[model samples]
Target: MNKTFKIYAVIFIIIMVILALLEVSKKEVTDWRKNFDVNEKSPFGLFVFNKEIKDLFKNNFTKIDVTPYDYYSEKNKKPHNILVVESEVDQESWNKILDEVSKGSDAMIIATRIPKNISDSIGFYNSKISFEEQNVLKLTDKKYQNDFIELDKFPSGRGFSYIKPNVQVLGKTVEKNNEDQANFIKATFGKGNIYVHCEPLFLTNYYLLKSGNVKYAQSIFSYLGDKETIWFVESNTKESSSLLRFILANPALKYAWWVFLGGIVLFIFFNVKRKQRIVPIIEPLKNTSADFVKSIGNLYLQEGDFHDMMAKKAQYFLNKVRLDLLIDTQNLDEEFSKKLQLKTGKSAELVNEAISLIKKAQDPYAGVMKEDLGRMNKLLDGILK
Candidate 1:
């Protein structure tokens, strides 16, 4: 290969080598984003919970990709218990879930904040821990009613400031102020019941893997009915509306995007490093304005069309008069001659003579030869100048 090609090839190879080394040596970072992805193995991800949830519930646990509304409305299969774990449930899906619930499908929503419709209808709202970094969580069941798990920092939990009397409080947490706040509850709607829990972080991989919190987490899931459950995986949303994140979220597209970025980096590095000499800008050949006028004049002269040429010259002179002198030459009469003289400060004789030639040129019957054309041109030029 040529020397320049060899240099570029070496640079490309070196860049690729560095990138590969960097990627290989990179430390694995613990992703703490609370996206609740069942496939993710991060601290806050639910990968561990998803694997063990079937054994915990004593049912066929499956992660569904569609919304609860779609699963319930479209399919004719037997009802499956639905679990929604999200930071917050939007109103639209909340309404759809309620519709499905009215049809006798049980759904449990565990979120940091309850939907407005649920809060307004059921009167269960989120509450803050009344104390410091740690809170004592308890189950209200007869067997474990007095048992409480102490967590390092329980920023969020289900039982809060208000609980409607109809709903049964299954679990609660005690703060530093010695007041018990409900975090888990069951409320009936139509033919089915919804288990609404305030704290979603309780069931994540961190709590499940650390400090025997798995027992407490399972205690909470025991409240769900004994049936096959479908974890509507839409609740694992990253809560990002960006287009790039959407592309990066898919595995196939994510690698394709990285490859595209690598190509762009190579293109920028090699192309920018090898700069080209300034190319002399050959100025486009100028077109003289006189060339167009000369060509038209020559065509008229060769055709021996003196009358046409005279008509054209008179038209040009009238346009000039209107533009430069601001005088109308439409009539070309005595009044026009007077106005032209007043506008141009020209002699009345010159103006009248020019008007007479223009009138002859404009008239069809007034046939003109080459001699007449020359006289008209000379007189018109004198008046206009």
Candidate 2:
């Protein structure tokens, strides 16, 4: 390769090596799955609640883990309070929860967004809250008054607004002008109350594990009262493929696999070449008529047959006259000479002289000298010109 091309290739290889090394040396951060699964180790999971608030729940109520479908399937006579965190319930699940709540059982739903039917039925609408920085949350409820709870910067969640008359505002954010926007609301239906908290992230491990933030979550649980059984609904429903699950579970393997795939793609891209078939060469045909005639004349000269050579020369001359001048050669008399002279535009004397030489060569025993052949050749050359 040329010097410039070699340098470019070296630079490319170096860049690829650097990128591969960076990828290999990279460290994965905490998994932090955004779902509110109680079983997961992610920051948004309820593992912290199970660890810190389990004893508190044991003292006041029974904590049960089950799906909405399973909870509604049980026909027990016991009074149970439902708790859903960061989960979207289908229409059937919503109907089941509504039925349970309408039958004098309390329920608390903490999610970024509640179902539209539930929101409309509960007399509140939730909307996304955007802020330049993190906002602090505080309990506005008279019974569980606390200091401001500092949340993370750029919290990813929504907030609620009370639309129904007599709806109780349980909590509000302490950030500047956002104080009037309610984040938690309690609405009474037939005989029980439905507590809806927009900021479900408050109950996550990331916030609860933070110093003193656990009190903010505990304050919300105070509204649950003395219900016998508390059901914790699982919200993460999307199942990942086995390969993706494995990669996501192992950080080192994920990065290594990506680097390996990238290298393989680059190798194939540079190494690939186009293949073509070879073409053949061909030559034009050659005319050997003149060469053949010269060889025959040479053979006749070697044999000393002047009559045959002169006769062939006369016949060839007459054939040329017949073809080129379009004249009769059967009879080489004076009349024929006159006609040839007219067609060739030559003097009658020269035409008659050529005819006389041809007649002489036609004789069987005639012998032609080299000087006579030269004279005849000169005459034919002049006529051709």
Candidate 3:
């Protein structure tokens, strides 16, 4: 049994060591999952175009950073071009964007999924298009027909379907199967136009670096036309603090945080001592004198030593009389009874009865019965009361 236990313990230790090494050596991959956050440094982020796009607008327009709530506010209502990129747009933000665009501010949205209100307002709906093999994209305009543009990595992106008659197709996906799907469209709102692009990954860093793909991205920008001022709406989000972000980014630190929380729980479970009251050391009340006399009388009765029990009772009664009444108990005559009656304020009959019982109890050869003992107890009780 001991050998088997040792082998199991060794195996556990080796497994733990391997897991710890893996945890330590594991590197966090650059998250290429498309978030479209312009501030993020990931490959799918828009950090590379931050300088170039801002410089592009520097000569003709001023760049401003705003949120959906801020841009819709009354105090900041300037007619400028709006750019938004998100994974999923909510109804409220979509409505606000439509309202802003209807007021003659051109808006361009690059997202995987657009909300129902925005899609309905633009007269188009988006659907997922999956390519079993690699595919390339082509602009529907004749001017960009020869441009080489390929979306080789992202096999699953979005495409526009059920486009209304009023909407114009801007670009389409070119697959070897000849299954060309519309992915970009331009629709007219109240006074301004809304350009909806289904594939936002085309603007990401990975595809932007592809050969001759920059021209494809640049062609999509031309739809904005001469509306110079640009308002980039940052997604409304609760960003994590620097320390928390670091802990989440590192696996070892995240594990250490969990271990620390577990230690706290264990400490509270083991160390939350319950406060208890101090127990008092109470000495049992010293056996009362009356109880002691009753116990001795019971012992004498058990042994059938009634004469001795009577003698002890008489002696104790006389002693109590002498101490409490300050009267002599040497004699048991009429004179003694009278003195006891006067001192204790007892009736003469009660005092005489007690004296007579004491005299009977003092006789050495007297035979005491249960009736005689009960009568003596009654007489003594009357006198004492």
Q: Which structure among the candidates has the greatest lDDT?
A: 1
> By TM-score, who's the top model here?
1
Against the unseen true structure, what C-alpha lDDT does each candidate score? 0.75, 0.72, 0.73
Candidate RMSDs in order: 21.2, 35.1, 31.2
Prediction 3 global C-alpha lDDT: 0.73
Task: Quote each prediction's TM-score.
Answer: 0.56, 0.54, 0.55
Model 1 lowest lDDT segment of ten: 150-159
Instruction: Pick out the ten consecutive residues of candidate 3 with the lowest summed lDDT.
Output: 230-239
Residue lDDT tens for model 3, 1-385: 4585467557655765676788878997878676666666677776666545765455565544555655576455656677776544456667777887888888888776776666877998656676545677677889978764776765554577689999999888777765788888888898888988777777777776667777877788777867665545454432457897889688778867756665576457545676778999999988699898899768877898767777878998899888887888897877887888787788887777778778889999777787878888888877777
- Tens digit per residue, CA lDDT, model 1, 138-222: 8888897644567664455335777778888888876775667888788888778888877777778887887768878777777
| Residue 130 displacement (Å), model 2 | 3.1
- Relative to the true structure, candidate 3 reaches a TM of 0.55
Model 1 C-alpha RMSD to native: 21.2
Deviation (Å) of 372 in candidate 1? 66
Q: Using TM-score as the measure, what is the rank order of every candidate, best first?
A: 1, 3, 2
